[model samples]
Target: MGISQSTLFRELRRNSSPAGKYIWFKAHDKAMERRKRSTGNATLAPN
Candidate 1:
């Protein structure tokens, strides 16, 4: 809740339901899915 207003607005736009409603559980699931997808794209380079 300490996030900036712009950050909050961005998340709301990103995780809002199809009906344009914001639900905590749905938003959390969406965020988790996005995090998982992003992490999957990270690859470590061999030293």
Candidate 2:
């Protein structure tokens, strides 16, 4: 909710269903999947 409106719009557009409906569970899953894929190296690297 602290995100900018444009960012919120972009995320909804990216993760929403085919019907253009936003689902929390589906969106969260999609975000987690993307993070998992994109953070592979980051997760392995030492902080």
Candidate 3:
């Protein structure tokens, strides 16, 4: 179908705290940071 359960779980696992808590706000920040990082690298790579 669409996104798989495993993919969602993997993202949650990666974004979780060291103590294994999934706080949505922190996860959102992490996701945004990751997006910016990937975008930066992609832009730089074209040079």
Identify the candidate with maximal TM-score: 1
lDDT of each: 0.89, 0.89, 0.87
Pitting candidate 1 against candidate 3, the one with the higher TM-score is 1
> Residue-wise lDDT of candidate 2 within 1-47, one digit each (tens)?
79899998898899999999999999999988988888465455678
> In model 1, where is the ten-residue run with the lowest total lDDT?
34-43
Give one digit per residue, the lDDT tens place, for model 3 in 1-47. 48999998998899899999999999999989988878453334564
Cα RMSD to the true fold for all candidates = 2.4, 4.1, 3.9
**Local accuracy of candidate 1 as per-residue lDDT tens digits, 1-47:** 89999998998898899999999999999888888878465678999
Prediction 3 global C-alpha lDDT? 0.87
When 1 and 3 are scored with lDDT, the better candidate is 1
Per-model tally of clashing residue pairs: 0, 0, 0
Model 2, residue 17: distance off in Å is 0.5
Candidate 3 residues lying further than 4 Å off, grouped into runs, are 1-3, 40-47
TM-score of 1: 0.67
- Which prediction has more favorable lDDT, 2 or 3? 2
